[model samples]
Target chain A: MQESATTIAIAPDQPAPRLLEKAVVGAGARVGELAEADALIWTGKPRDFPSTLPASVRWAQLPAAGIEDFFDAGVFTAHPAVQFTSAAGAFSHSVAEHALMLLLAGVRYLPEQLRATSWQQREFFPHVGSLRGKTVTIVGAGGIGRALIPMLTPLGAHVIAVNRSGRPVSGDNIPAGVETVPTDQLARVWSHTDHVVVAAPATAQTRHLIGADELSRLKPSSWVINVARGSLIDTDALVDALTGNSIGGAGLDVTDPEPLPDGHPLWTLPNAIITPHDSNPPQLRLAAFADHVGANVARFVAGEPLEAIIDTARGY
Target chain B: MQESATTIAIAPDQPAPRLLEKAVVGAGARVGELAEADALIWTGKPRDFPSTLPASVRWAQLPAAGIEDFFDAGVFTAHPAVQFTSAAGAFSHSVAEHALMLLLAGVRYLPEQLRATSWQQREFFPHVGSLRGKTVTIVGAGGIGRALIPMLTPLGAHVIAVNRSGRPVSGDNIPAGVETVPTDQLARVWSHTDHVVVAAPATAQTRHLIGADELSRLKPSSWVINVARGSLIDTDALVDALTGNSIGGAGLDVTDPEPLPDGHPLWTLPNAIITPHDSNPPQLRLAAFADHVGANVARFVAGEPLEAIIDTARGY
Candidate 1:
């Protein structure tokens, strides 16, 4: 094991520096100025990361679950010596709940009926669907996927989890009854599933992983739910499918080129339920990140392996 | 016990007489003409029930969970000699799932976001809530309520169920971990609850049960979700509260004067999600009712007691 970190700095801070500092102190680490620290807990946006870190710093912690920001900002390549960890599992429960909300919203046409100027019961009745006796394929069987499995199983959904390497889920928090498969088998699983939930991290290999070809394999009554990242699906293909009524619907929390332009067709699509990527909103994110920092800081101080360590090459 | 019904009839039947006939026959009861039927499955709208029934008809099975329709139409009072059973628990799963959808939609401002013309994540962020660490009081701890408790408990909610008699749930399907309370105690449960789901059958005692007084007792942040009957909540009081932002929001599947006329204030309310009371849409209702009829027919033919037997005076 590596030696314990003697000092750490909270960097480019805006929201919860004091809360994070308290957490660091609670974890038996002394807070020091950025230049003098052996480790840094980064709380600012990835674009705000300093061009260089002092030689004293051995590791840095990121505040967000998706580390694509750092990769896009060239932070990892720029600082080859720094080991980085992300607040991945910290907010999974809340996000997973939101994803379930989106999936159910799509099933019941909550979005369409909510916007109706007149009573639409008869019109919407035929389209109303249920999660019961349905099969849902969850891409990226990590923390969020694990949290969602328990909720889905009780509702009678057969959960097919697609992980990068299809490692067996081994945590006490993880529920049984989920069938895990590697990403390679995702193509084979689509036809049998009633719903598809994208929860995988945004990586080059996963980008546009579910495009026209994959969507074609799904039933016309199937719903595609994206809670991970927008880039995972090809937006154009999604728009075509929704417009053509080829697929049942989509429940998207994230979109490519997000903050999807004002007049975007997706905003008006009846089958598409878009939430502007607010799955894990600000207040919840702050508390969850703080929790992650506190635990990771304790681990760092104890010379223990950290949670959510990122693979720089994968860019998750 | 009533003698076994050798023959049955699927009556008035707008939705699925053929399906019910098949179910009845599948249960070993022959489908005969109405006048010759010893048992009748009333599959049409309650208003359509014949004013007089043949003396041969010993039992009449209702195709709906809400038996208030029969009582309101004077069918039960007119035929006091006929035993009646409701298709209650059969469709509870679908309705319970819809209730969960509404609760989550109310928390996440799904309706508001769905209507937004532009990306509104930041605007909607502060209002987004989660079921986690929430206390949800479920009014009407019957079939739908029981099914919902298991889903809510797994999501970290403390479920307080309110029933007519507040009897401890005893069915095998009734999941444990819910605290059952009488409807009379609803006043005390509001302030502590983050959300309230109304699933009670609409009866004389339940009309306007959640009015200005009950709404006033709740925290302003609390959400009121009605998936049962519109009358359970006073629409006028709800409008006033929603207009004044007195409560957090509402996810309403049923409404007073349902098929709420165009230009109703609710149609434009930002916080209120009105869904035309389509929670248990046609397709699911048919299959569920068929299942109930099949099971009850088998029980009746075997000289066993029926399920969901309705008390004429109580009107549930």
Candidate 2:
């Protein structure tokens, strides 16, 4: 069958960004008016979403990874017939990169070195560590976990990706030989894995995933990095581990009582490295989003399965 | 023509190391005695090296990157016929990994975050930076510079490699598209490159390579990382840049005078990160050396050219 050129529309601006416009054209699609376009790229909020989409508009691409606000605003309900895809994996690269930085910093004992006023090479020699040949277990094998696998693999780290199912995580960027495990079997990994990176969602079942019991199983030099939601790790238990030097340290972008209250013990802890949760900042998001748009547009043109499909029933 | 099985001897220790044995065997060679072996893997001190080697010994693998001690001990002068490959690139991975951590930490404003006792997300948002789409000019296309290219590429950064020859840097692991420039033209790059990583050697021509002239040209957000000798960057110039906020920050593994004095300002500078020249700790050196042995042994068995051939006159 012969293919025809597809048309896509960008909303909330009379002239969309040159980046988004170029993305559409680069994907073999053209930027057109909403009335004639076959797809709509929503760059505005849920409230700004059109109550009605053209019948020709079979798909819509949202700018956010999570669309709870869109669902609450009834954008999904207003266009139940249209296929929806959220920007899920696009922003993951930056977050995954942050996790790697935190992990490397903690393992190499950068926190203590930063606070030093004198050369302590002899005293700090034993504390320096490397990720080479070390097993890094990433909880919640979603966008962040999958993004992290490739980055870690090049550094000679073995990855154990955990999800609800034991299905192996595979991608062009993610190298082969990665071990996959079910979330229920997480206990088996704590004692064996060298370090942990929390990238799971904040669900009731996942709350406190790394508590006192799990922290105790980790090696004294193991660093715990959290780029996901704050609740996944037990903050009190983490403080205990850092205070006692039972584990190496904690690199947290998120915390249980986030914006981690002023004067929190974590602030004073020498072993903790905090970043105030700015892994994926605003300046980087637009370009990442534009890239996502390009990929999905190409997929739509090919009539292939689109990425990050939103499940209306699940309200994801 | 048929190839003969190669024999390698591990000196000083009768058993040598099971790790080195496995590496030799894995590379399709076998372990044998010094008198009958075709190659020698020296794991002992320079003083312990044999004054004479078997006529059959065609190649030798030394365990140190910088063989000044071996040269001082007259090991090379003693054996003029055998080919020598020093452990140069093997240990660069650990040091390169440390460089990546420091660059990321400085760009993401990690030092301030580590010192914060309150949730400073709003205040920190503007400071958090991403390496994606940024230019990273790596000074010295030696082991560490080459090793780091692949690691940074995965994070979406453009690389500029500076070397004496200006030859394009290419390797099995290094991706294509890296821009190479000759050292004489380095003055033109400071205004354009987003970050700088000093991995060059310490020599008369290289002393204070990044001085007042270079530091003054860099952007306010540019980060300079030095895993090489601290002499490459002028201490006074770097301090001025950091204090004036002329550049983003500096991540230093080596400092001036080796074991910086107790009251040095680099230690207390918020924009500076000092690691006390421990990027390649002793504990991690052996494994890295073994990997280097495996690759060179495989080449020897195949009668191919080996890596890191030392030039006695250069004294590297």
Candidate 3:
């Protein structure tokens, strides 16, 4: 049988439909109308998925890496025929770099150091630290975690990665010399680590994963860095830990009740360095998403196994 | 010939005289009185060098890497017999990491990001950027510059290192693939670079090395990170550049007229991040200095060439 041209559509609800259309066309896929679209590039929120998804569509490409929202929305239970793929690893590079940035900032106390109006050299000296000879625990051995390993290793940090399973993750992204452990072992790893970077996907099981118990396990000199969803950490516990000087510091790119309200204690905390949930650089977001779409479209056209296919049961 | 016992005195004015004394004794050197010492560790300010020097001392170790003060004091011109070694590379790891921290903070608009009390995600998206694929120009291809190259290279930055000779420095400290360029060509390189990290020593020739003329050559989006000495960049020009948005931003750990006075314009500028010259962690400083002293004392006992020996003529 002769190969047929794949019919895809730039969803009307996408953040930038024109950009999606350009990417689809650039990838050699025809932009079909709603009734004819075999696949869709979904750019809308998970809550809006049910209303926007067409019965004709066989595949749906989600812009977000996290899919816990979809599971909560019951998309999997409703649509058995459609194959869903999330942009899981598309923004890994950007996000991993941000995590490193946050870690570096926390270790060096950049926030407090930058706040000084006077020469506070003597006061700041004891707080400053180098990443060298430090132990870093990455809680979530996925794309972002893998990307962070190489960057951290080059700085002489011993990286310990945590995944759902203790098994080794196979990928070019996984730098050599990293110790992979299961999530349950996170407690055992805390006391030895000087830094903890949260990159786990948000789920009921993982929510508040770094709560009071986990915070208490960490050394007084340890810093907590979260580039993943803020829900992964317990904000109340974090605030307490930071305020009470339980932990060295925290670099949070995401926060619970995000767009953290005005007069939040985190805003005033000297140890807290918040970046408004923007780990993925806005300048690189669309381009990276486009690249993912372009590659996946080619795979779909070739009748090959797709990348980032969401396991309906796993919801990652 | 058997190595003679070397008597060394830990300077009274040193930050941690007890630690220095312990290290010297630990390295097989006896702690002697200043008048009877064969070698001494001088930890006083550069201006106090002439008054503090003892004629009987044959070898003196300066705690700071930059020795511009000795040149102005005419100590080198007067005493040609005594061998002087500065703790040049001992603190490189700490300082380089701090420089990287400053660069990352500036690129992410950390100063602005931390200022937000609400989510303001959309407002921050456009300002966000990553160090990946950025051109970083590191002034002074010495220990800190060399250390920074490897760290930046892993993040995919094209590193251009500037030195007095513009020749590739030979040492394990120097990372591969970095382009070593002469200081004279800085004007030509600025437009292409996204960031400039000043790690040059403070000297008459280097004072105000990055003034208006140099700042103007850079792209308006470029960030300037200084971890070396405040004198390298003209502070007045820096404040003007940041305030006018002539450049992207400035991350200064060191500033002129040290302890930048309260109410300084640079303090209020949203684009400036000042850290009060505390790049070297105080915890690491004494230990690193002691290691350097121990190694140099060993070399002195063996009558071998010392490490970090200063060429007073060069005024570094």
Candidate 4:
């Protein structure tokens, strides 16, 4: 049987044409006539797309990891039967590494040394903490969490996984001696964990998952690393935590009202280390997402179950 | 058969009662009959004591890790045959952690962030190198070096051990799968390594091991972390390397002068992060040294091999 023709309809603004074509069409066909295609790959700003699409489009794949743009464009609500999956694991390793970087940076007091270059004498320096003997509580023990656990375990840290389902996932790569805790145990784990890495998908239930009360449970020396989403934490509450020294510090890759406006108090907080939500190291996200898309495309061709299928009702 | 009394000498300026009771006499031995003893334990500044010690002393144990002070006092020369041992492995773990802190700090660009907190949100911050995929060359792979290998391995760094003998020393707890290179391969490995951690003992032959020419071989992105004595690296050469950005950066826990003088150019170097040689974490030195001393004391009593026995000829 001839392979079904595919048309990858990427936004004009998308920087990577090769990536989009490879992800959607694979090696089976050329991007000849878009009008006679069976599949469509959507990318970039959805606001510029037409109100309606062709009936021949059997499936539509989004280029971005988060599907909020599709929702904002009312495509998901309008097309009820369309299959929806995300590039969820696309940036898992990069996000995990970013979180680890922040944790190590905070514990080692990189900021303090940077600020006071004049006082670089050996006798009057500050003593900093190490990651070797600490417990790390990873909220949302999915792909990113899984990636982080192995990285942390080798550094001599205890890994605790907390997920929404309250059930443990199976994988050989999970560090051999990690504790998988359900989300219900979060508050308890927070009381003692040395670091908290928020990697959960942003859903209604997860919004403000870590707020004032939860932050209070953490040790004064604890650090929070958020690579998941800004809504997963309460911004105002976090500012309080850092200012009061209730929790040691934070390494934020994402934040509320991102592109965090100029003169934001967080920029000045001595303990808060903020990055522009661009934590994905060069080529890491592309490689991961490409693998995901490839695997899904293969399964689609074989009439097999697609991995990482999103549930609209769950909003993940 | 009575475990014959061992006489220990107490210097005049020493804490008289305690030294006399503990070192000169065993606990509960007659304190007044100080002259009736078989051996002498030296417990005061050698200069304060007479030039010639009583020939009754069979061994001398110094309180410091480096026996340079005792050697300076001519103790080694005056009694060449007297078995001498100094506390070793005392600061191994602390120094190892300090080395890791510096490496992490340099790679994460902690120094830069503190300088530009005001404009942190306006633009995309530069991506700093990560230790996740790097080759670390550890010079003088002794106690501290061995302790650090395990820590570096977990962070996914390749550790190459460079030492005098070029023979493989068993790093019992050092993570498996690390490579060991002879000193002759130092220049060859320097070009390939992303990090250089100097842990060699300060010695005449080992001085300036990482000088101008050797440093010039390193990639511009590589970092140097020195937890070993400062003399191992030529201060002037390192300053030039930092100023020129020939090597990426440096984290120095120990410098030539114990207190790196205020207004020193090294303190102001943008690429260099200096900590006043006080990398030893609180109580680590005391506890580890005490354990070493206790072990040696037991070995002495049982006629067993001692730990960290200093080689007078090598002066390490």
Winner by lDDT: 2
**Tens-digit lDDT string for candidate 3 (B1-316):** 9865778877657444677877887778887777888887887776666554567788889888778877787767776778889998888878888888888888887888877767788898888887876899999987888878878877778899899898876666455777888988777787678899999878898999999988888877789999888889999898888888989999888888677888888887889888878887677887789878988887887788999888978877
Instruction: Report fnat for all candidates as fractions from 0 to 1.
Output: 0.88, 0.82, 0.83, 0.29
Best by DockQ: 2
Error of 2 at A121 (Å): 1.7
Q: List the residue pairs that clash in candidate 3.
A: A259-B119
Model 1, residue A181: distance off in Å is 2.9
Task: Report the alpha-carbon TM-score of model 3 versus the true structure.
Answer: 0.74
lDDT of 4 by residue, B1-316 (tens): 5755334443343454442344223332232322442233333564653455445555555656667776777767776766777776655776787787788767766566545544453343444556765899999888788888876775568889998887775655766677888887777786678889999989897889999998888888788988988898989999999999988899887787656777788888988888766566544454455445545555555566766676876666
Pairs in steric clash, model 2: none
Candidate 2 chain B least-lDDT 10 residues: B307-316
| Tens-place lDDT digits, model 1, residues B1-316 | 8755499877775444677878888999998888888888887788888888999988999877777878899889989899999887889888899989988988877877887878887798998888886899999987888888888876777889998788876666556777888888777787687899999989999999999998887777788999999999999999999999999888888889887899999889988888887888888788778878999999989889999999988888
| Better candidate by DockQ, 1 or 4 | 1
Q: Is the docking of candidate 2 incorrect, acceptable, medium or high quality?
A: medium
- The total of clashing pairs for model 3 equals 1
> What overall lDDT, based on C-alpha atoms, would model 2 receive against the true structure?
0.91
When sorted by TM-score, best at the front, the candidate numbers are 2, 1, 3, 4
Give model 4's TM-score versus the native structure. 0.67
Q: TM-score each candidate.
A: 0.75, 0.88, 0.74, 0.67
Candidate 4 has which clashing residue pairs, if any?
A121-B276, A122-B275, A122-B276, A122-B277, A123-B276, B7-B39, B8-B41
The weakest ten consecutive residues by lDDT in model 3 chain A span A10-19
Off by over 4 Å in 2: A1-10, A13-40, A54-59, A80-83, A294-316, B1-9, B12-39, B45-47, B54-59, B68-73, B80-83, B294-316
